[model samples]
Target: MTIKPLIILPDPVLRQASKPIERVDGELKRLADDMLETMYDAPGIGLAAIQIGVPRRMLVIDVAREGEDKQPQVFINPEILKSSEERSVYEEGCLSIPDYYAEVERPAVVTLRYLDRDGKEQIVDADGLLATCLQHEIDHLNGVLFIDHISRLKREMVIKKFTKAAKSKAI
Candidate 1:
């Protein structure tokens, strides 16, 4: 599978809410494969379809740490069905945002309903890093970012930096 170009921060496409896939077909499967390859190449634990300019409610995640067997998972039209009141914090980074990272708080546990790669429905009860990763990607499907969970000052600073960087690249 070929690795797709990641859409970086400050791109308006990254802020658009993704549309749900009408069906999971061969082309969709290929896109998912490409996404997994891109995520691995990015050396990131999670990636959203919007990050890859797909604008679909899809994501790929592999939270397995280095040296462990890669456990790539594809989530299509994912939704958080339930979440715990208890909070957890993780220093989260995004493929779209590149090198920047910051602590973000989310539910310690989440129950998600999503379509698997084959279009089969799957329910997952996730905790720890997996939980955080799932939440982050789902936010992308909804036109949100991990930085949005941070303080306004920090978020604005990040947006400004990326916007300037994007402008420089255009010059």
Candidate 2:
């Protein structure tokens, strides 16, 4: 598996809706593997295909705490089946929006269904950090960002900051 370069914020690619994987072939497996590698290299808990310029409905997550055994999860074409009325706030950061984090409120519990690495369907009942992570990554598949959940003023500021950083990097 190779570590792919992450597409940062202000990259229009991140705003494009991802296409669902029609088949779980070797190529899809390779992409998932690469995504996991990239996530680990970024030292992030989760990553989406669009974050690396691959507009496919794929995501990898490993929220294991430091010192614990690594647990990698691959979700293809994931869909949220249920969400709890209770809300939780977490300081969320994205691999695409490096170095910036903001508190975002999301469902504390959620039921999600998706295809596993073996192409078998699976459903998970998630809460706490997992729920937040799932929502954040899935948002990428739908061309949404966590910043979008924040106040318009904050969202605009964050976008402007990233846009300026991107422009500086292009110099």
Candidate 3:
């Protein structure tokens, strides 16, 4: 599988809501494979399709700890069905945002419905890292970033930083 180039921060496309996948086919499967490869190459636990310039409701994740077997999962057109009122915080990072990380609070448990690579529907009740990862990726599909969950001052600072970096690179 090819490792696709990640669309980094300050890209207007990241703010665009992703469209749902119409069907699962060999081409879609190949894209998922490429997404997994790109996520692994990023050394990140999760990645959204929008991160790679594909504004499609898809994400790949593997929350396996070090030394554990990789458990790659693909979610197509994922939607959160339910979420617990209880909150949990995790220091989250994004491949698109690169090195920046911050603790963000979200539901401690979540139930999600999505189509697998085979186009079959699957519903999963997730907690801990899985829940957080799913929520983060789902937010991407909605044109939301982890930074959006943070304080406004911080979020604006981050956007400014990335915006400046982008301008410098263009020079």
**At residue 35, what lDDT does model 3 achieve?**
96
lDDT of 1 by residue, 1-171 (tens): 999899999999988999989999999999999999999998888888899898999999998887999999999999999999999999999889989999999999999999999999999999999999999999999999999999999999999999999999999
Tens-digit per-residue lDDT, 15-90, candidate 2: 9999998989899999999999999999899999999999999999999999999999999999999999999999
Query: Candidate 3 lDDT, tens digit per residue, 1-171?
Result: 999999988999999999999999999999999999999998899999999999999999999999999999999999999999999999999999999999999999999999998999999999999999999999999999999999999999999999999999999
C-alpha lDDT of residue 148 in model 1: 98
TM-score of 3: 0.99
Worst 10 residues of 3 by lDDT: 6-15
lDDT of 2: 0.95
RMSD of each: 0.7, 0.7, 0.5
Against the reference, the lDDT scores of all candidates come to: 0.94, 0.95, 0.96
lDDT of 1: 0.94
- Looking at candidate 3, what is the lDDT of residue 8? 88
Estimate TM-scores for all models: 0.98, 0.98, 0.99
